[model samples]
Target: MRVVAIVLLGVHLAYAGTHSLKYFYTGVSRGIDFPEFTAVGLVDEGQFMYFDSNTMKAVPKTEWIRQNEGEDYWDREKQKLIGSHQAFKYNIQIAMERFNQSKGVHTVQMMYGCEWDDQTGETNGFRQYGYDGEDFLSLDLREMRWISPVPQGIITVLKWSYNRAELEGRKHYLNTVCIEWLKKYVEYGKSSLKKTVSPQVSLLQKDPSSPVTCHATGFYPSGVTIIWMKNGQEHHEDVDLGELLPNEDGTFQKSSTIRVTPEEWKKNKFSCVVEHQDKTVTEKEIRKNNASDDSSSQRSIFWQWIWHLKLDITVG
Candidate 1:
């Protein structure tokens, strides 16, 4: 939606947060990224801001505020605000507070009045208290600087929807939040990499010297493909890319195996190429003779076993 920009004209007197004053100017300014919707400005009400590295300098918060809201300018002297080189999370909190104070918009209250979606809630897409497409989100303020794409990969906006109650209840919203794309992004790289099948298949074995079967697996949102090879050349016949199995953390895993008895296993180079995006990863395990019948399935499924991970935080 195209947002009609509203120029803020600070509620106070002539010396407001909307323009750069002539007599004052703060050293550093804190503002939001218009493109990404992330705020990154200092907020010293008095315009007297300092930093361990840059010392305290005179800068007006009004002008900084005016930078985005209106045509207000900052004065070089007099007006002052303290240093605002604080953490972004804390800064965002300040932004939210200021927004609520200025506009009489209380997010917590909005959230309270809106329907609950804690069961499968995700801090994704745009808006803080609302859902985007599928209309799971109550609001779709894609026009705001701080509510759209957001910034720094952190959801700075407190999501809320103006018409969240209209998205219907759990039955439909759940499916809305249960986005199909979430199951499409897999955590690849080395941490999630499984090294069960390594190197080339030195040998092959099958009970009746026929075709062999194998499975492919990965974290959720992953795509799997079956790739059969003979003497390092890709073999395309009789391979099936089965329905992907889901991971606990929302990834998809899949496997496909063809029954290859002893004779076929010995002559064929077998592998299941895991596919995600434009990358293709290969894992190999070959048998020299068609008589080796100990299923490789056991080792393949080892990573499926889970252990817990925990972390503790303290707030003083």
Candidate 2:
């Protein structure tokens, strides 16, 4: 039997030379509530963004992962490569090989985000986990930008309208994303646009031992906070938060980094919080222990990376 992947739907923005992307995850659930998993992504231009429910967090690759995972993110993350979000190890290596052969350069971005549906007759949305992975799907955007906080509500519209001059109005780009899926704004045809925004929190952790170095992964177009909390206290020393990486689609990702000590990490509670639009939200807590330590003790196995398809832009 052949497995069909969910298609990412996108629409052209009028007057604006851009597009937005959303992916529907299709997989066999066998009728069971699943676990919660978040997606993380990165780009060739060093852009990063991610969405967990309605919270989108954008930041530089190095710092975000570091903060959330503490010292173990790097090690445990490698183990996760075999699970939901497979690293570009295989695909990126292939792209590099092709570029090596042609002596040319091309750019691509990586993204990881979590999904869920609340069908428990209780909550509002949907989310759950199953198998080694669940209904969540991993995606890649070659040239398209993932515009806006992955739009909210039932009715979402992206239109590129020409700059209409009201006699002498300011030269506006004339773009909007209408979120009509909610109760207050549900409309079949004529509805106003909801100003959508996504923010991110870039977390970084330095070596508890010595010379602290930071490296990480991320998605694009997010608005949030990037701070180091020691024992739940905001520690703002030796930290460098970077600017947001704007997506070709319009949204952006923010980031930052810092180095501390094992003595610093063992203090109490450490966390990175991302508060963005969409009524969406996400967060991560750093434990003195790392996921890699668990994997090592369990003697886990992993799969290699590979790219079976090439992503190209399409238009109607």
Candidate 3:
């Protein structure tokens, strides 16, 4: 993820909470063939109902898409979307070839999101695209600068897309086509969406000499914080924070690790505190007694164990 300022129509914008608009194309592409695209839209971190050419349905259907008569219907717009999807489906291969690797699953994601003041609707933020899960290009919209390097041809096309005339045209389309879709998405879908699903937390010490790792999985709306705690206080030293990644089920997972000496591990109880969007907190503890080390054996062996913790928040 990259952070940048947002500027539109020669006006400067202030930074605020992240608001994102993303179009993602993901599929496997082998050899010279165009990759099959599974395109979807995301706002903030939640899925918004969008046309999937493969499914021909508003995919990953939320309650709003499922209920609300004719609200999720977008058959007439599918043809227009397909053209954009195909451009990326073919262009992802071009990007791979340019990098000299063209075999495997390819993903192209275009994102327009920024931290902008809601009252003023101003932002100093970024417009970016990634290829195969890696950053390929980025534009600092506020500074009118290309934040990442791109080939000459690609940059030329990007410049044209950002040109004033094209931008005005896009703004019109967005007001009519995008904003309306977003209004429906937020009004009907967003509030009802799950903010946090209790994480499946695990403690693993695979090797006797390696660090103890606490892994969390099956969470939603990925702004999760995983921290190691010594006793009841936060422990930050020697701790490594891992990247939050998506799961096959469209949920999220992450992990954190901390190095502990054998004596320290035996003497102190270590805990992992997970904080999520819902204000529901969970703590998973790894104690010397709970750790799967066979006391009968001369050699110490630590086994992996999983603990599920849940906390419910009640709003008064």
Candidate 4:
């Protein structure tokens, strides 16, 4: 009997892009309350995000293992780190081979972009995309259905990876083990704001540097807005916004710089304002003594305060 896979009710537009990618891999592990998985992405091999069941957020693998996991954790779980990294490389190789069977067309880049929805629990899926954003394969775990066509080779690989016995074992794990874990993880992730720290904003200009930069550091939750103002007027042009980088402690930092002549800088009141969780706003002003262009100032501009004002979150 020829049986066709179920067609999803809704129409999905094929994302446009070609994949010049050669490899991608996803590794899943059992956790107490939440499962920890790492996907060695096609875009950046060996560079991927790690989500700990305890943390309930994706962190840099190195930072998570070294700082968060601690020495005791490593000592207790011997070979876990080495095994995980080795498996990561091995999976990318598998992904590379699978990529060849995807379309047989011109494919150079591979993509691995998948996300899980802890809120609904069942709403999780994985997708492989081309460079133009077109999907190669997509799976909807909620329905246990494929959103796109599943090639015969891919199905064969999946079956070979997990036969009837393994499939039943997976069901047992998902039903029994994952239920409690998902609930706790969702709760922890929501209450994470209780441990929030307001950002430390600094306006700095080093020796031999003409640009004054505003640096915001040590804030939880990556959503932050930074702006440069001159004499209380916001200036948009000539502002360079840096990427939100992760700290060793899982907090985030970002910077914005603007070029200003020494004369213009001295004449104008320059300030940088940052907004983070719960409308917490921190603003800092930049000033230098006229004695030398490189001297740093000690005058505090503004004490950090929380404003309930609704403001647009402009993260660039």
What is the lDDT of every predicted structure here? 0.29, 0.28, 0.51, 0.41
- In the range 196-263, model 1's lDDT, one tens digit per residue, is 22112122334444445444443322333556666777776666544433232223345555655556
Candidate 4 accuracy as lDDT = 0.41
- Cα deviation of 268 in candidate 3 (Å)? 5.3
TM-score of 4: 0.41
Candidate 3 all-Cα RMSD: 11.6
Model 4 per-residue lDDT tens digits across residues 97-160: 6546333222112222322243343422232322112333333335443333335235533543
* lDDT, model 1: 0.29
Q: Candidate 3's error at 211, in angstroms?
A: 4.2
**In model 3, how large is the Cα lDDT of residue 123?**
38
Give the lDDT of residue 286 in candidate 2.
35
Per-candidate TM-scores read: 0.26, 0.26, 0.62, 0.41
Error of 1 at 284 (Å): 2.2
Which model is ahead, 3 or 4, in terms of TM-score?
3
